[model samples]
Structure formats: structure tokens, C-alpha cells
Target: MNALKHSLAGLAAALLLAGCGALPDKPARAALYDFGPGSTPTATAGAAAPRALPMIALAEVDANSRLDGTQLLYRLGYADSNELRPYGQSRWSQPPAQLLRQRLREALSAGHTVLGPEESATIARTEGRLPDTLRVTLEEFSQYFEAPDRSVGLVRVSATLTRSQPGGDKVLAQRSFTARKPAPTQDGPGGVKALAASSDAVVAELVAWVDAPR
Candidate 1:
């Protein structure tokens, strides 16, 4: 009995050691990125900086369910327009919608009191005035493959500006903006850089368009 017990203990110890050795290594961490222009804005030669429109509330940006996540998405080719793919080890710092909304808010805040939906309620209560509404829907935001080794970053968005009204909301203006930037390296890093540029360009255009005369 003693001999059998000692053999069983020795076998258990060997099995434990082998299990530890067979454990797999940790996965490679995903790389995270954000949008940026990477330089200070140059002063424009103009009169006094135009005053921001009273106040603008940015509504929650709507997007396709797949694009709402942080995963970096890509397309195989134009032939597969409806098919989307995600990179295994690339991701945004935050979900794409949040990132896009934050960028829009920052750009608009340059001269306006940009508020989220929750914050806009306070304005209505305190001032008896509801601010103008800015609604955006992301159409496409991903890296596209033109060929086996060629790609570009593509971004498309639709924006609508609505004014407060007695009976109902009035759409002052709305437009769609699309931008594409060719990747320099045809890989994850290049895609991220190109996407950032496209994002920056569309944001600037959207802000200007929303404030323009109809």
C-alpha cells in the first residue's frame, strides 16, 4: 500500500510539471491608435475670429453595428463591397464611433459650446432654449484593398443640422462628406495614418458645412 501511494504521488507531480510546460504563451497585444494632425494650427490672416453659433448639441452618432467596436476593419476588394474584415492585432484606442464623436466635438468647440445630448438638457432647463442639433451617421470607415498589396483608408459620413422650432425640429442643412487617403506602407501603420488624415479632413469640412448658410 505504501509503495502504491508513493508511485501515485510521483505520477501526479510529473503530470503537474508537464501541464505547466504545455501552457501557451500570452497573445501579442493589439496596437491602439487615435486621430491627429500632429502640428499647431497656423493663424489665418483675417478679421476677428468669427463667433460660434449659439450652441450646438451633438447627438449620438449612428453607425453599423460592426463599426461600433474598437476593432480595426478592412475590406478585401471592390468586388466584395458588402464584406468587411477585421485585423487581428490592430484596434482604435476607443470604439470608432466614440473616437469620431470626440473629434467632432473638439473641432466644433473651437468657437462653439459643444454639448452632448445629456448636457444639452441643462441648457434647455436653465436658459429656456434648446440648442441647435448636429446629427451624424457614419457610412464607411475602413481600410480598403485595391489589390493584394495595395490599400487606402476610406471615410464617409452624413451630417444634418437642425434648429429648434415651436412645433417640431427643422433641418437647416445636411450633406455627405467622403474622403480617401492612400496608404504609404500598405499595412496596419499606414492604414491608421491614412485613416487619421481622412478623419481630420472630413471633420473640418463637416463643421464648416454645418455652420454655412443654406
Candidate 2:
């Protein structure tokens, strides 16, 4: 009976060891991604200072609840376009609105003096003059799959430009912008690259629109 008990214990110990070996030490973590570093100056050495650009007060970008999270979302046109799904192992480093705002600010900085809403208000109080206020609303941002293997990164936004006056603020311009870029692959990384490209395109359009005579 003692020998039998010893044998059963040994078998149990071996099974325990086998089970431990089969299990992973830690669960896999989701990959985090963001828009890549924007355009870099060609040469900093002896480079001329950039000319003064128009100053504009950029308000915080707004978005719907669906885009307020870090989940990397996608839609299947072939299956059910209305149902948005999240990738299992991928996520944005920040919410889509924040990411778009950062990218837009960076791009606009190249040709404008971008200021926050609070900063603009302070300047208005001190200088008695306010720069035009720009408000943006993110309407759509996602990877859209037309077919099982074909996809594109899609983005849409609405922009409103307003000027402050003694009486009240006046709307100067309002427009909607959309951009789509084909994904290099049908995976998360590819979606990220495509979205970044689409965002850059949209930013360029916004800068041009703002710079145009108003």
C-alpha cells in the first residue's frame, strides 16, 4: 500500500509539471500604435527661420462615443457594415479624437500659429484681439473592409471656423472632409499606416482651406 501511494504521488507530480510546462508564463499583450512621426525638416544646419504664419485658435476636437476609446475598430462592407468590430490584439495608443487633433495640430503648425482655446482667450483679454477659432468634429474613423481581403482606412470630419467679435462669435466657414487610403495589408499594422496616410491628406486639405482667402 505504501509503494502504491508513492507511485500515485509521483504520477500526480509528473502531471502537474507537464501542465505547468504547457501553460504560458504570461498572456499576450495587445499591440499599441499611433500615427508616425510627421514630416521632418530637410536640414537644420544654417536653415532659415520659418516665416510667421497666421495664428488660429484650435479647440479640442470632439467625437462620438464609439471613437472615444482606444480600441482599433473595423467595419466589414461585405458582411455587416453597420456592426463595428474591434481587433483582438491591437489598440490605438490614444483615442481617435486625440490622435487626430495631435496630427492636425502638427500639420497646421507648419503653416499656422496654432493656439489652444484657453491660450486664445488669455490673449484676447490681454491684447483685446482674438484669433479665429477652429472647431473640429470627428465623425468617422475606421478600417473599412470592402471584401474579405481588401480594406481601406477611412476618416471623416467636420470643421467650423469662427471669428470672435465684441457682440459674439461669427461663423466664417463650415465644411466636411473625408479621406480614404488603401491598406497595404489587411491587418492591424496595415490599417494603421493607411489611416495615417488618410489623416495626412485630410490635414493638408484643412491647412489649404484655412489659408485660402476668407
Candidate 3:
């Protein structure tokens, strides 16, 4: 009987100890954002025909520290212009480089024959000559706030067109593109929407530029 009482006491003591640490509050869920589904641009009447450059390859996008990761980045006014920050509870579905490359491929495919890096490489192996290639480096992609309440999605990218040459690949043309669109709301979703619009706008202009006379 004494032994049974001792075992019960020990059980009670263990229960009391287990209850000492109040269950930690669950952490808030992280929000994941992306550009969502994008469609190929429709060909317009009287618009310049597709560029005669044949199939072009899209190299993996390059990015800096601010854009190299998956976290959604932002910045304050001109005072904190150099201070880049990221949202703790918000993140992108993939790295910015990957997202940009996918968007670029989808958008450019409408008006041009765009092959991925692998595709271009395979063609070069068999055909002895690869087509032109478009290499883009994303300099910035983030939400910028002019004031506490006003914000916009800002994106900047530099693109270069290269083609096969006797010695090696030759750069045909290169330029930088920047876009700023007012955010509908001062949150990640707003920034995402605005950025997507800005991206499409840039893609449209780039496609036209490629087909334009040099």
C-alpha cells in the first residue's frame, strides 16, 4: 500500500513539472508571394514582326545581395535609402532571380523564339552555332516608400543581347530598364501586384526593342 502511494506521488510530481512551462504560443505563419500566372503577349496589327535573330537563350538572372534571397525586401525614405530591409513574416515563393527568369521567358516567348540556357546549349552542340542569347541582371526589386503611407514597387534590370561570333559571342545590344508602379496597398500583396505589372510592362518594351531596327 505504501509503495502504491509513493508511485502516485511521483506521478503527480511529474505532471506538475510538465505543466510548469506554459505551452509556447504558436508562431505566426509566414506569407509566401509570387508573380502568379502570366500569359504571352498578343501580337498586334502593324506591329513589327518578330526579330530575325532566330531562337534566343535566357541566361539565369543575376542579382545582388538584396535580391539574391527569397525574402521580400523594402526600403524607407531617402534618409534610409542605403538601409535595405526584409520582411520577417513575408517571403517570396522562390528566389527573385528564378522568378524573373520565368517571367522573362513566358513574356518573351510570345513575340520571340526564346530558348532556355540548356536548350540553347544543346542546339549549339548539334548545330555548330547557337542563336542569340539574352542575359539579364536584376539590380533591384523591392517596395519603396516615399512617405509613411505612400509606396511603390520598384524594379531595375540590365539586359544584354549576345550572338555567336567567329572568335566568341558578340554583344549586339545592351540596356537597362527601370519601372516604378504605385502600390494599391502598403503591404506585400500590393507590392507583388504592382511589381508584376511593372515586370510585364518591361517585358513588353524589351520585346519591341529587340525587334526594332538597330
Candidate 4:
């Protein structure tokens, strides 16, 4: 009878000790944000919209490069399940084709001429960050996806700009912009947010370049 009582007491003590050693539950992860074309442009109070200046009409880049659209290509996604063939699956934060179309529309909107899907528009000016005009290419596009929040993207563009004059079309400018984004904490949403941030840099630089006196 005494042994049974002792065992019961010991079991109760063990339960209490186990309860004391238990860990608290972790916080639930938040739902990430994923904007379609990244975040929308924000205009500050008293700040005027970008000037719509005259420029050359842009031509569609050739398909020599592995770009999905005009000048947009995304690095492949990571597949957690496949440890061996890690790159077996690719998950794009945004569709490269769609993103390029949106970005091109936005960039051209800043200029004097309107951009459209049709090729009827006269060639006002050609603008891209590729190495060659007729055969521009996007060399490197690196992306990193992280946990708990955010994604970082590094875009390297190389292009050749060709302009059409009375004399004929000629190559104007060619260069690359290595746009980088700091860590974002919103998972899928974070990528778009980061893209918007990165796009801002590109737009600012392009604006200054176009605004500069020829």
C-alpha cells in the first residue's frame, strides 16, 4: 500500500516537472504580400509627375537572348523538397513577360510618345540596357528567396540602343544597370515590394539620363 502511494506521488511530481520544462508555442507566420507589378508608384505632396518629353520609339528586342519578354527575365526558384536536383522547379515571384510589359509601359509613359502593343507607332526613340540593339541580351539575373519574410533580386541588363534618323538608324547608347534590393520580410509580397524599390532606382536613373541635354 505504501509503495503504491509513493509511486502515485512520484508520477505527479514528474508531470509537474515536465510541465515546467515545456516550451512556449512559436508565433504564427504572417501572410506575405505579392503585388502584381510590384508596388504602385507613389507621388509625394507638391511633387509633380515626371515630365513627358519627346523621345525615339522603342523597337521590340530580338529573341536571341533568353528573355521571356522585352527585357525582363527572372532567376529560377528554389525547390525545398528536391535536395539533389535543387533547381528542379522554378517559382517566379512575378511573371517575367508580364513584368516587362508593365515596366516598359511605365518607363515609356514617362517619355513623350505613348507605348502600345501595336508596331504601328513610329520609332521615336529606342531605349534599353542591353549590349546590342538588334540583339540585346540580359546576361545575368540572380534572385534569393528567404524565410520569415522578403526576397532580394539582382538584375543585370545589357543592351544596345539604336536610333532612327533621316540618315538611317544608328546605335546610340549601351550599358547595364546592376539593380540590388536589400532583404524584405514579406515572403512573396516582399519580392514585389523589393522589385518596386529596385524599379524606382532604374526609373530615377533613366529619368535623369533622358532629361539630360543631348
Candidate 5:
């Protein structure tokens, strides 16, 4: 009986080893993504240098609660467009708002001296002049799937330009901007590319609008 008991224990140990060996490997870590390095200026052999606009302060970009996390989100427009879903294996390197702010700062710097709110305030106290301020609110940002195979990255935002005055801040202008770019493929990676492209397009429009006569 003791020998039989030992034999049963040995068999149980062998089965346990086999079961452990057959278990599937651990799932892969989620992939991280961000807006790619922004566009580089190319020299036109004889093109005149672009004139810089007046210095401006950019407030932190704000977004709705839906975009407060780093999830790569999407909507199935064909089914329930209002329901947002996140990709399980992909995520943004930073929250969408931070990413947008970084991109905006980079683009705006090309045409003007970009300052933070604090920096602008310090300058105002010392120099007696306040730079114009740009405040952006991200309204909508997600990949929308028209079908299982067709999708586009969509972005929408509102911009407010204001100037400090002796009494209060004066609103210079307010405008809404939106852009959409079709995904090359209907997957997380493709959605990232499409969103980046849409962001660039929107930023280009915003820059033009900001520099336009007000």
C-alpha cells in the first residue's frame, strides 16, 4: 500500500509538470505609441525666411473626461457610435491631451515665441505687457469605424485667443476646428497613423488661423 501511494504521488507530480508545460505563454505587453516626431523644415534654396509672429502664451490643453487616460479608443459607427471602446493591446504613450499640447507647442513655436501661462504672467509683471493667450479644448478624438473594414481617425477642438487687459482678459477670437483622415488599415496601428495625420492637418489649420488678421 505504501508503494502504491508513492506511485500515485509520482504520477500526480508528472501530470502536474505536463500540465504546466502545456499552459499557454503569458500574453504580450501592450504596445505604446505617440505622435511621431513632427515635420522638419526643408530649406528652399532661395525662399525668404518666414517672419515670426508676436509672442504668445499657450495654456495647458484641456479635454473631456473620456480622453483623460492613455487608452487608444475607438467607436463603431455602424453599430453604436456612442459607445467608445479601447484597444486591449495598444495605448498612447501619454494621455491624449498631453500629446496634443506637446504637438501644438512644437508647431506654434515655429511661427512665434511660445510661453507658458506662468512665464507670461512673470513677463507681464516685469515688462507691463502680456502676450496673447491661446487656450485649446479637445472636444472629440477617436477612431471611428464605419464598417469592420473601414475606419477613420477623427479630431475636433475649440480654440480661444485672449489678451490681458487692465480690467479683464479680452477675447480676441474663438473658432472650432475638426479634421479626419482615413486609416490605412483597420487596426490600432493604422488608427494611430490616421490620428497623427489628422492632428497635423488640424494644427496646420490652427496655425494659419492664429496668424491671420484678427
Candidate 6:
């Protein structure tokens, strides 16, 4: 009777285990966006025209990644740094791509004529490219840690700005802007936030340069 009872108990435990599914691992949180170029100012309808409007062509921006194997998609986070050591958990948040498109649209519309405007159809038909324009491309963006103390970041951007006829394809004005900012704090989020702010500064400078007089 005792042996029979033990066998029944083992069978009950096995059945219970089979009913429960395996637990899943924790999700990997991503922190992206927070880099370069904030929102653009609104433009009034039928606003007074400036001296000249430039047709601008904006290319895609790029960045380095710490987590993902590919560099195409990356979040705002820390890479191995010389000055600062890793601390705490790695946590990140990224904005949608639509935000970038909106920012670019706003920035360009502020003081320049963006490409593909219905009113500017004549301009495009006349000139192949815009005048006094900028094309921004991000080359190297990463955060460096100062061991046991602080952190810093470097943002390298390349911009091709020019002035020429719509279809002439000539270069009038061009320059490149590089900005570096030291981390405000050692905390992970704080450091990442600072870098993101620096990125915006870089973009703003690029826009201003493109719009400035040659």
C-alpha cells in the first residue's frame, strides 16, 4: 500500500509540471532618438518671401551601435569609454522615425524653401538643385566614459551646402561642423541625455551655416 501511494504522488507532480509553460526572458529595452535637431518652428501661410529660397536635399543620418550587431539601427546609450566605467543597468528609449522627418521639415521650412513644394514647382523645373542648401550626414557619434569619474561625447557631421541653378549643379557655399561635449553627469541616463543635446546643437549649427550669406 505504501509503495502504491508513493508512485501516485510522483505521477501527480509530473502532471502539474507539464501543465505549466516555460517562463520567457526579460525584454531588451531600447533608448534611441534624443540626438540632433529638435522641433522646427511653424511657417505662416503666404508669409513674406525672403531674398531667395534654396532647394535643399536632406540625406539620412547615421550612428554607431553598442547592442545591435548592425549599425543601421541604434539607440542612445553608452559605448566603451576611456574615462568612465560602466555603472548600473543599461536602459534606453528611442523616438519613432516620424519624429526625425518632422524635425527636418520644420528646420528647413523656417528660413529656406524646401524641395517638393507645390508653389516651387517652377523653381524645380528651372533649376536642377536648390540654392544655398544643405545635405547632412552623420559620420561618427559615440560616448566615451571617463573611468570612475565622468564621460564625454564626440559628434562628427558632414554637410554639403551649395548655391547654384536648379539644374546647373554648381557649388556656391559649403562647410562642415563638428561638436564635442563632455558629459554633465556620470549616471547612464544623464550622460546619454547630454550627448543627445549635443547632437541637436550640431544640427542647428549646420542649418544656420547653410542659411548664412556666402
lDDT of 1: 0.86
The lowest-lDDT stretch of 10 consecutive residues in candidate 1 is 35-44
Candidate number achieving the greatest lDDT relative to the actual structure: 5
* Residue pairs of candidate 5 with colliding backbone atoms: none
RMSD of each: 4.8, 2.2, 4.9, 10.8, 3.0, 6.7
Ranking of models by lDDT: 5, 2, 1, 3, 6, 4
Better of 2 and 3 by lDDT: 2
Candidate 5 Cα outliers beyond 4 Å, as residue runs: 1-17, 42-47
lDDT value, residue 192 of candidate 2: 92
Choose the strongest candidate by TM-score: 2
Compared with the true structure, what per-residue lDDT tens digits does model 6 show for residues 75-163? 23344333323333433334212233345556667666666333344565685433344455555545555454655555566667555
Better of 1 and 2 by TM-score: 2
lDDT of 4 by residue, 71-114 (tens): 22234244441221112123344434344435544665664454
Model 4 TM-score relative to the real fold: 0.50
What's the lDDT of the predicted structure labeled candidate 3?
0.82
Candidate number that wins on TM-score, 1 or 4? 1
Pairs that clash in candidate 2? none
lDDT of 2 at 194: 89
Write one digit per residue (lDDT tens) for candidate 2, span 85-191: 99999999999889989988987887789999889989899998799988999999999999989999999999999998889989999999999999999999999
lDDT of each: 0.86, 0.91, 0.82, 0.47, 0.93, 0.54
Candidate 2 at 183: error in angstroms? 0.6
